[model samples]
Target chain A: MAKITGQVQMLFDLNKCLGCQTCTSACKTAWTDKDQGQEYMYWNNVETVPGRGYPKGWQTMGGGFKACTNQVDLSAPLPSINRDYGAPWEYNYDEVLTTEGGDATVGMLVPAPRPDAPNDYSSNWDEDVGAGAHPDAYYFYLPRICNHCSKPACVAACPRKAVYKREEDGIVLIDQDRCRGYRYCIKGCPYKKIYWNPIVKKSQKCIFCYPRLENEDPENPLAKNFCVTQCVGRIRWVAYAEDTTSNLYKLVNVWRVGLRLHPEFGTEPNTFYIPPLSPRVTNGTAPRIPTDLLAEMFGDNCSQTFEQRKARVEEVFAILEQERAKVAAGGTSELVDILTSYSESDRIQL
Target chain B: MPLWPKDTLTTGRSPRVLFVWGANYLNQAKGFLDVYQTLWPKLDLIVDLNFRMDTTALYADVVLPATSWFEMWNLNTTDLHSYIIPFTPVIPPQFGSRSDWQIWQGLADALANTGVVFQDSLPDGTTITRDYATLGTDFRTLNTDGQDLSDDKDACQFLLDSSVETNGLTMDGIAEQPARLLETSEEWTSDLLPNQAYYGFQRMTEHLKPLHTLTGRQQFYIDHDWYLSDFREELPVYKPPVDADLYPLRWITPHGRWSIHSTYRDLKFQLRMQRGRPIVYLSPSEAQARGLLDNDPVEVLNDHGSLVAHLCVSPRLPAGMALMYHGWESYMLKNNLDDTSGFKNGWQGPCTIRIKPTQLVGGYAQLKFRLNYWGPTGNQKDTRVQVVKYAGTLP
Candidate 1:
């Protein structure tokens, strides 16, 4: 293992995330557009929660550790290219377009399934299709990327030692040269962030825009990740986890508002999210998003029972409501100040 | 074309030329079937200028390639925003394409070479003269400022110098950062602050300025003869949709999340996030009742026309509504081996163009012909359709 120098963390404020896919588009344009197998890969994707996420039911697909144990769940399944993550289909533009004096027989321009990835399901196939029916239906955008965990399962599962967390920034990167595309990392990763690049015969994941952080371009030196900087909602904050003065640290440690996703997975993801607050019903009887659902996602069950986890979620929601009420009433709140500030200094401090 | 009807009433002449620019009117226009069948044959020429091979270009007599956003020098401003953003070319136009300004300049030059003068006798017995020989020269405006306005950058600068809101601003200044408009225009009903949020009708409400109306107090009641006739719609009233008897479900076409109209709709990355094609959303119960499961091909139709697309059974939507996000090109919804819903060519097959008679009234205050503001908006929301499970054979 390399010397522990630093670990950067990200804080995503779910309140503001609109799931516009601007960040996803920016990351795709910056990194993965040209590569053949990377066509289906969205290093940063926004999925509508309370829905089957990218790769279908990734939450229940199984991976990481079992409960409080460090043992990797041997029953972890690999996501299918066609069934889970839909193939990068091509449009029949040539046949349908009128550039060549038109083809009257051909119908509208539609997706022609790629033979390599003939797929029916897409990365966001269940978009906006939240779990309940009609008025009770609820959904929120969850923009995800490689968590860059302190103990990444991709690093542990790789027999070739190709996948490693950087000592400097804690960015988990797959060594393309060493990667043989065994795909164990894909099975081991609980978040399903790791993707198999069939053309390159290597495993790939989000690099956290390490080159931008390295200040490679003298003309436009960007210290923050492309996704964080290009985020239209300004929902993301990136900073060193050890920097107590940073909002990422304050939100996760001091304020206790940001919680890691599936903490019981035991990878200790560096990514922390400010859980989405559900609207109280018309009569203020129950939450639009059930507490049990929120708990199922963000609750840390390794340290407590499911009931306790649900209580914790409720407690956090209450705290958020209280702080919001205080701010709405023309009062002051440090948490609100931290979240509301549009300054890049407050959000992305390297 | 409908609003600015040339030689219609006074001249008693029909329009012979059509220039469809940027917009995909054939694909997006409501009651496009009427335009194609009734209006199209009467036109002598139809020219389309666009960066993409949009549906309008498919039917055009001549298709002129226009430079894209990244390949053009232009100024961007909208009624919704307070700032004027400048678009400086990142790269030169490729594949013999030219900017819109240059394309029109070329057309002027071509017309000048023909030496044909466009002369029209007015109703007052005076002749309206447009000498084609001097058109190329006049188009560049070299006589006034000795600057060839045919050049896109020069044209952009001339626009900046001409507009009172952008008079002092330069292309370079806006390129660095967007320049705020010096004053608000009538089109924008709000006063623009430096960085504050815009609240419409602030001048009328806060400063007591009279609005552009007869009574000037946000009056919706229009007691015009047209409004009082058979409709009696002087005040707002919910009239049942005209197509209610034709179909069972309302087709609500909302703006798409993946693409802005048809812009990036064909991109592989954008399509990968979606179901790889255009899809229609229905309530779970509705889908089940129609025997349509997720990813099942379905045909949505009415008296207007029909369209074929895969169904997405979603609980998020309400019953009695079939929601299809807008901007899917006609070329994308064909009846092929994969789709046999019997629709010939997507939404391009045609739909309703139900224009309210009250909207045609013009003599009243604030009801005059204002481009996009006060006009006969084609009531597309009232369009009704029946969703049925497509019994098409799968590959």
Candidate 2:
């Protein structure tokens, strides 16, 4: 048994995932298409994971300098972190030009860094786009989003206390009313998920369909997370991974069902994944000899798994045999069924 | 006006004229100096390059504080993309920044004092790119000229208003028809083309016909059949320098929202975003071997010079490679701090050193002091080794 912290998490098997981007499109159709929600980003993105980050290089852009938790300055890796502070800037490129020879070159213009790096760096920064390309170059799309961390750095980093981790589901949320756009939370989050709505100057993030959760009670067919509901690969599992003995917990924590991008930072992130690491199984049109270790971690049915895995280019079709069986069986003897049964009764705070 | 001797060029057998350069790539754009020095026989040429100096304009014995983009209004017509984009700013620049046009205007005046006057007018022309003569019905009332390169603020306003065009779109009324054309083989408006593009940098034109304005008429030919090269036959011709140590690290700092390289380094908000020093990006596999962490302060030294930066450890880089971002400076108007106190932490500005424009430093700005995230580049990365032999199947 575990404490009902009201913290819930979702996990996806990256090994089983195909990067169809259905999840992204689904969210766009459900939320971002709306006026107020246009700028509000969501709970997930399918990054290349190892190489190119989603929505460009969100990582190298740097947000906060999370101070180490240890009293002494650490040469070795430490557990927690502190936010790094730096100045922000705005620009206008047309402030210094006059027309000549029917051509007007820009003046006083310092534009922001462009989308791609110099030397024509692509999202797949490593792969060459033109001439003598690698024949067997491989990359698997890794969908990523806010991890709904157990000890969210964003909540602790907000000096104004504008952010709160819901006691019910443990979901991190921003109080738009109280937020003054200090961006401390933005700095504190190692993930850099939190963003300032340039229009309203408040903080916002994925609500996990809170309105739908309360109204339709989650059990209702209409209730769905725009990102999770639309995954074609069916790899997205929107479960309350609280119970320890269940397969969900085992897969996420022990078998490490999902791996973290990095753990040394120690944000206690909730998102977990079965990585799309294709280190082995190199060469040949098809891998005749499956990497034994990879097959074992995933299962003996490597043929079926790889066959289905290969079809993961479009994420809208995720319902493989394993997932179909789980959904059809109608609630396993897992902790989730027990917890949700009591969900209505307790005034739970995450 | 600053005073100087008229015989400054003939003071010695040959006087060294240090030419300050930004990223012009064109060595002959300033060939006028070579012509002048040959006639006068008094100039010894030495070109000093400041890779990304937005603050100072280095000319042939001429010094100008180039006005930044925010300091001037701009109108531009892309000969390649074929459309005019008007760039306007919300706020005036903070201090001594001046536009390139103004600097050239001054150079023209200076040359005039040397008993030379350049013609201030050029021949009129038209491009078959859009058949500019037949662009609109009345030229004033009808506006759809079929182009996608305009960044006019009125474009956003047009999206909101109810103006109709000959094609029944408001954008056309403002002479801003999108350049999207049907593909040669596929259904014209398919997602195939859209898939190749990024968020804002979408290509509007489908068929890249050789623009006619510069040539006086539209020239149609297969993609391969064009006599297109200023210095060579290739479009992006890579001309390696004869002197290897002259320039290395084909540095490229694409755009970001914080602002272009040197434009925003002065303001309090943006100053925090820039790197205090020029940061050279290295792959993680390269760093691990050299004993550097993702944020560990390390020096990226080449034969030309060295730049210090926090390591950005990511798997994206294959190996035997590094990168650096360009543009940032104090502009001399902002509060200046001595670099002695904050050496390890790094200083924020346009270059590695805060020397006056007259004296150049071999570096770029930091943008900001923030932690950049990269994926676990490899199980064990070795960044320093020059030869990046992939150690085979690393995590």
Candidate 3:
């Protein structure tokens, strides 16, 4: 693995995410709308786990490092434009407007008929359809962007050597000028985040809003990434992973509550997720989500992760409960002060 | 005015001609298209004045375009917030469109040119001729020094200058800094939270002023004769949902976070974030019991009518209740293939569920007639419906 200095990392607490898609819309308006080819591209997407993500069935696709060799296998099936990434659909406003009405009848409005294509899926196709039955069903939103991994499979699989990670901030970016649309990086990426813009005939992926980060004054404390700052849920915390005083460092290194997605892939993903803690099921003490399914997503350490997360959550709840008692007695708690310091100006720091 | 106007249209006793201003009835009103069709030829001269080519404007005989929000000067205040926001024109009104105030002024001018007269009886049973031409002059003289108040800027200024709540505030001040709070009375001022202007009910409490109630106090017991004789609701009481037992599921239509009512529902990017059409959320078990899958076209039906939408089996939703976020345009609804004629009459299927009427008791004390009060409150959530897997495929 190549060593990097001052790497910026992000931690997303799943419990706080409401899945409102404010971050997704903000990223889209800032970067993607100008190009027609970029209509299907969403650099930041929030998908319900235990659901078929933006591009259908991304979890099943094989890539990343082989477990035994820890080497990138550039032989995975390339993401199909039709089957994986669905085309955007348009509505039929003109037809609905001109329709004549008669006694006891009203005009109708509906989406335009889809073109003759086998692929019908769109981004976030299985939204809100989490696994399990009623009264015990479970789901949590997983917002995905480029992981900017330490050992990027996309960087290794690129035959043209167009993909590279910045030495300064560890942001993995594709060189559009050098890219010849070989699509090797697309096949090598296990996350299936790289998109092939047919019109531009080049590979494209997330840049982590590097321009915004680059323009930030080093003296300023309120600077933040576009997605991290725009999140309506306030679930995202971003800072240099090495910065001991940062929230990211406190959560990942000190508290040890955050875990990377699919750590078994061995890319050492920089984006970490705080796994969801579900309510106890009525039938048993087990959580709402089946234990085996979570194990499949987060690797064999899922049980240990859950145990640690549960203990941490209980500790926080205990603090809150104690704080409530203190407030009732006309006093205050330092624990409450620590948790409630989430004003906009203090939410993100350089 | 009745929202549905079912009795007024069906009886055919009221005026035949209709003039609709800002409202998009074809999308907003229940059974409006049916009423329009039933009284088509008989009800002549349907005029619509709106900013966009909305459903109502498309069906009208005369469609007069009105200025869009960004192309007009207006003052806005919401019950939820303390800010008095100003909407100053960023660009001139597009071709053939005028502000609503300007349109009304023009109509008044035309009436004055035609020499119209007004006659009305006083409370003491005296009737006299009133020169209606003065109405046009009165509207034209709203601004200072006989300036043309028909202009939208002057009209907005007149509103700000005349109201005590906004007397100290000016359009220029708001233009420089939008969302400035109105300068209210001294008692209403908040020292701790000065920016928020925290005072909605200070007059009644601090000034010891009487409330607009029969007892002139915060009386819990309503002494209205109609409340006792008709509704029997002398005090606040909890009444169970009217049709909860009729169907298996209760339907809730709440305001969407994406739009205010239906205002920004048509924004392309906002629509892209959604399912691209109306969707109904059901609990996983409820969907499983009906052999339904996620994104399956489902028909939600009650006694009143049925509409088709994609089903989203949500774990967050509790059993025995279905949620459909409101403000989707009528045209964005999926058509039901079961309807043989394909007439599109049931576009608002989810909203077609039977609405239970609130007690019609009124005309006494606090129950007396007033704008936005003492009338039949539409029971939007008092609906029950069953969902069936729709046979047709969704685009």
Candidate 4:
């Protein structure tokens, strides 16, 4: 393993996500849509937890370091082209136009048949299907992008060493010019972040919008990461982990409320999640999504991690509530000042 | 007053000819496409003037392309914002397409050449006949005679120069900034002003001036004849929704978060995030009762019509309520079954549910005859429906 320097990190608060997909659309329009090879690729995606994600069943295919044996498993079955990533569907508008009209009571308008096979699955195949029964079912959106890990498996498995972690920000990127179409990086990633571009005959993954980062001035607190600034829910925070004054550091290290996804993979992922808080069901009981299932997805410490995160979130909510009361009584509080000051100068520090 | 053109068409008294502009009837109206299909042969002509080759344009006897927004000069006023915005063209209209204003002008000129006469009866019982030649000459004169306001730019300039609302503002000024603040009687110190009254009502409190009302003051009760009619809806009162008890689920279709109405609904990048199809949201419990699951094909049916969409078990949605975001076109929908069909294979276009008409009684003060003021409105939210698992293939 190589010693990493200052690492850029991100935290997503699940409690705030509205599943609007503004972040996904923004990323696509900015980066991927121009290339024909990038049609099936989404560097960022929001999938419903406890549901089949994009590429159908991505969670079961395994890779990354095996902690029990203390060695990386380079061999893993690659994601399927047909079953995993569904072909994009195109519509038949001309058929709807040319069809003849029927009688008033029986007239109908039908379009030409859709292109069948190989494209059956879509990006959000299982949307909103949660784990619980009836009125008590609970689900939350889990937005995924490349983790840009401290110990990226893609870097280790590439035969040509095309994948490398930047020393400056610890962002993992594939060297497109140096790479051949071996797909070893795709199998090596436990998160399934690496995607194969058939047209380019190369492997590609998220670059954390590194070009935007290069343009950012350290002195400007308002200079934000692409996904963080584009989020309509305001759920994401991004900053270098070494920047002590950032909200990212305060939330991740000082408060210890942010939990890394699947820590057992031994990849040291930079992205973190603030577990969601579900409201009590209409049956007047605490809503529950089986703890064991969460543990399976998040690793063995899921219960303890969730408890610590929930307590800190409750504290923040209490402060917000108290400040709201003061505002109602025609008085201002410092809590309001801290929350409202999101301008460029106040949000970040070099 | 409650009569819809569809009802008239169904009764075999359809219009002789139809001319459509600035509206996508197939996309916005319920059961409109079906009606068009049935009545296409019966009608003499169907003309459409639109920018895109939308569903309605395909069926038109003559499809005249209109200028896109970026190629036209326009003004927009919105209640949500304080400024009046102007849209200046970036380029000329492409591929022989004309601006809506120019197209209408040409049509008027051509009709005048036909030497037609139009007769109308006035409110005081006076009948008047207008010669097309004179009417056309008068219309053209407004754009000519040293004014030279034949083009859209000249027309827009005249509007800015004449209106007191836009005092001290010009077309050039608006073109430079894209928006201008509507001037008020107050002194000019700031570029913006409060939307409503900025100060307290001193005239009403200190001078005791009468309000603009029927009694010259605020009145809680209305003494209008219609208000005291058999319905007796004189004062505001609680009334349950019309279809509250007819069906198990209340249907709600709110504006989509991705687009404004149907404006950007078809953007490929935007559609990728929305599962490439329309979705109906339901609670897990409600879904279980109907044998539905996430991404399962389901048909939402009511007396008005039936639409097929993939079901989504949304935890945020409440029980006994179904939600579908508005603005998906009929063509985008799958297995849009007709209401008259008895659960058999039917057309596969987008199916819009039935719309109910609200109260149409008018003629009272504040409710007198006016365009878009007092008329029958579509009661979209007042709908009930049942969901059944669909055993259909995707289109």
Candidate 5:
């Protein structure tokens, strides 16, 4: 593969996401709806955290690189389309609506859960059902798409060398002609973003709406990704990773707020996240989300102990709190302004 | 019924022959079961005009096939934005369906064929009397100051020309792109400045325009007789919920993430993300206490009525609360647990119409009766219910 000079990155503020699935629907309508076998695929999906995510137990699925190394693990289990990702089932709308007592008094509209495929799980099966006891319960929305990692495992795992990251913008794409439908890339991606198109007999994933970004017309206003532009919460920002002036860079580098997911996977994900903040207790000292859980998700890729990671996450929260206090006291905060991104230019700096 | 009270059913008159169009009131309206059971039997007729088989159409005596939004010409406006969006036909009406305007025109023609002449005097000493022989022709040409509006496109143009906000907007221009309002009206008392977010009451705050009140300012206290009477609700104050002590769980029905109210709630694509059915969400602790598991069909009941749906154990919900995201048709329920045996349908039926007497106020400044302007909203959040695991069959 060619050397990737720079990559387009995205920052998602979990605080703003309402989990309305607007972005998911937008992505589906724009890209996946055209194909036959992509019915069950969601190139972009928002799932409630602390719950079993899309493809069920994706976080535990063995894939990506070995910890603390740049080596890809070839031996990874493939998720069953029927069992892990529920095959798209349709309703008998015509039969039920036309049959006797079809007014739904007697002859009901039975969902045809295809007998060949068990419709047990879906992309957001356990949506909004987070973990915790009452009165102190906690949950946040995590919208997922292809990370377009700097060192993508799919690119490394493709035996036929079909998957490659673009040297100019670093968007990982599979060459349809070169791909032999080996299904290794689907297994290699730890995020489980890549899906197999049974009809086409190839793997398909998010392309980040590259055509819109690559459009030569500088006057075209709608030059952003569908997921970013259609996001109802306005929780997303996109820019070239190397653009130091962009808010994406400022949030990740200067402010030190945006953290990558599963750094141990060693993909160097271009997608960074501003972690969801916990409401302060009565004393305003501790965070509601267990420090261990936060650390487990957002901790460093280095060999840091659980205590060290916990302390680091706590310190990040403290910084957030201090900045919030500074703003409350009528002082200007760059972090707050960058995160808010009131203007369209602030959010989409191609 | 106080003169200056807050929140009441805005429409003063009871509707006998309801004509539901585009709205799924049978499924979405609060205390709908009560209205259906008691009031429906006494109603003269119920007609629903829809492109799809929605819950309202199932119960309606006459279901006229109306053109879908994609197959119609209409003007759409939003309070959140200043733009007047246009809806143009992507395709003509399918399967012999007619647009709403055409449907009414046809009805007028039918009435004219029956030779039934109806007349009513308007408040301004004008008469609504029309000869049955020319009813069809007059219905198309008479309204909106002698403009022909029998066709959907012509009606849309008439509406655009009639409204001050969209007075100058043309169909071609709106079809190309959404046009911003020409100016704010009395109803929307805000200046729609270019490149600015829409905020309510900008005219009063930013421009210092007089507010529509007796004092010509934002009034906090009401000095009406009913306000200072035995009720003594002169100022807005927190009142303890009446049903909180009686019922253990508060039943709150919020709009779902998958739908806009009840629209597209039954679409297969939207339901696939959900549990393939209507579900009542309970806190994990509440579910545990009731010996219920996730995906368990349960009956949520109260003094008003009962509804059967699948239970989703969600930690996002707080204890002492049962939440069902609104917008599930009555037909969505499979195992009917109502009193009637042999194949009945359950609905969203736990809510009761709790009309606070204070809400029935009228004849006060800005409190006079107007359709949905200032009235008691259908307050369903305060309803309380108990959820128990269902021992019956599931869909």
Candidate 6:
């Protein structure tokens, strides 16, 4: 079942996790910061899986679910995102004005590093917080981000030809210079990994460390992608997602595909999950569930389960359903025309 | 001092920091150490202030309630150029919530209340400075040429020809302000510094130095190597703690993106990510092998305290590790945490433990109450909610 791109996925066993957020913090520190991060972000979210996911309505809200189909419409204008998704382009014109007698000087130079307070306090201040609540309680974190599907919805929804999926490894990327910030891709993507940057005013998401991925050192370039490498609990992993000779991906799809994350949403997200074994299910001997689900779940890029990708104009198409602008006044059904269904390979174009 | 936090507080010899860092800010923590090392303090005994309630607090002498980021004066303009914005009260100090400055202010007022006045001004007086208004209220009304603009805009203004002091300002010609942090290296070259007050302090500590202390200007550092006897022959010498077993888990509890410590716990929007049950996270495989569940409730136990949460199984974490976002409360539960709940206190102070026994809105259990009393307990199993969204980065 290996995909054409030879891409594989991974699954994490929550029971083994100690909730030591080394992976989450390491990622934020290593990659999610810097000017590129801020507005359009969350390359990693260590969400409590027992609740609603990190992104509010990503699964059922976007385009609803659909079975895979091959024909995708390339020329249709892509969908739009939530109105306030970007922001008010406030002008930081502080420099444009000057104080009369008091010159418009920088006035002060703050320290790059603040002085070490004798006592630096924070919220989680206990020596052993979150301990001893249940006789046999289990609380584990699930790190989430862009799955970079073998067939990326973002690549299909771009009107500006701004997004592309890398051929070598199916990592989806946005060319900032080419992106007009139409926000169409953001809405179309079920994963919602793409983000609109207010500073640069462009879309951004995880790059899968392409530069590091192509390096000759043999070790994953993002060997230190913050999370995988620096986890104090040793619960993380880093490997070539393409090669299935590894046990990571094979275990995911083959051993445990029944436990899926919002599968009804049709993005074909690459990140897979070995559903948490609840106390009820595991009251019996939990199957010696293979430790490696990474390759099995997503290792196959050409999964036939994903071939039928572009049958559009379904009712779940939020923006196209006039969900973007409250359609009070009468206007041509821009939706019916743009997303008008056709049997051509591009099928329902929108 | 052990770079890695010691299981027990390090004392009698050198400084040891039990840095309770947030996974959301690993770089910020590392960046902090790189700078904090420059100004090592005299004595050390530590208990970090991460959000989770399980870290050891037995060693802490005074459990002072502290201010959150938004609660304080967070004045920032440009990169390094900015003025201090006075801290404004947000929600009437979440029951017993107190600012770090107020803690000192309260201590100062208490000390004064006892008639034992200390030579130093209140410790947190510098939370923000009225450095400008210090000259006098007339500074705001004064005209360009030093005329009282209250009377007439075209009035003939006059510079004070003689030395005159009213309140803190003087009639001695206008003082020139420093252009930036470090305009001249010579100013930082010597120990003797300016006598005038800048911000709130009169002395020239690193805070008052020119901004470019990055070039070895006004930075502070201390060498604790002399106090170490357990050093190995490692080149970049570091002494791993001998008592790592006392607290095996390198404790970390991060704040919610917008939750100010214990605040915003039971609020509907905030609880969306977590399905109403306190959860600790682990890999699914571990949960399976150990009879754990995708969303099974469990107790997080350590020497200091314990918390109850739902299980989150995913590959996002490493083995033998777990994490719980801080600011959970018993009040978040539809049913209050009871003795039968088998839960223990994970954290206290910071208005977190400020609670009253009130009936839960939905259920028949009674729990401790507070402004926003959050704890680690509940029956949230098999739940997932979406919490964030974006404009147009994805297709």
Question: Which candidate ranks first by DockQ, i.e. highest?
Answer: 1
Tens-digit per-residue lDDT, A36-67, candidate 3:
67888888988888888877787768778887
Predictions ranked by lDDT, top down? 1, 5, 3, 4, 2, 6
Which stretches of model 2 miss by more than 4 angstroms?
A: A1-350, B1-63, B70-73, B88-98, B106-288, B301-305, B319-395
Candidate 6 C-alpha lDDT tens digits along B101-133: 445444444444454322333344433332322
Per candidate, native contacts kept equal 0.77, 0.04, 0.33, 0.24, 0.50, 0.00
Better of 5 and 6 by lDDT: 5
In candidate 1, chain A reaches a TM of 0.93
Model 5 TM-score on a 0 to 1 scale: 0.88
Per candidate, the number of residue pairs that clash is 5, 89, 1, 5, 4, 138
Which residue pairs in candidate 3 collide?
A: A109-B331
Query: Which ten contiguous residues of candidate 2 chain B have the minimum total lDDT?
Result: B376-385
> Which digits, one per residue and each the tens of the lDDT, describe model 2 over residues A1-350?
12336666666666557665567556655654455523324345454533435323555443323342412111222111111111112244334222244332223323233211231122222211111112333445666667677656677767788788777777777888899987767656656566555567676666666665656654444345667666666666565666665444655554433544443344666766554434333354343223332332232111234333333321211223344456568845332232223322211111
Q: Report how far residue A95 has shifted in candidate 6, in Å.
A: 23
* TM-score-best of 2 and 4: 4
Model 6 has an lDDT value of 0.39
| Model 6 segments more than 4 A misplaced | A1-8, A18-20, A36-40, A70-140, A216-224, A233-242, A253-260, A281-350, B1-395
lDDT of each: 0.79, 0.41, 0.70, 0.67, 0.79, 0.39
True-structure lDDT of candidate 3: 0.70
3 versus 5: better TM-score goes to: 5
List the candidates ranked by DockQ, beginning with the highest.
Answer: 1, 5, 3, 4, 2, 6
Per-prediction TM-score, chain B alone: 0.90, 0.37, 0.82, 0.80, 0.88, 0.37
- State how far residue A272 of model 3 sits from its true place (Å): 4.6
Q: State which docking tier applies to candidate 6.
A: incorrect
Cα error, candidate 1, residue B311 (Å): 0.6
Worst 10 residues of 1 chain A by lDDT: A98-107
- Output the lDDT of residue A334, model 4: 54
- DockQ values per model: 0.61, 0.06, 0.30, 0.22, 0.42, 0.02
lDDT of 5 at B165: 84
Instruction: Write one digit per residue (lDDT tens) for candidate 4, span A1-350.
Output: 46778798877777678888877777777888888788778788888888778667777677777763336666667877556877665444444434455321222232112212444466765666566666577788888899998777788888898999988889899999999989888877878888898898999888888887777765654555566677877777777888987877776666555667776676778988766656676667553554445445553232335555345445544544577699889998654443354553333332
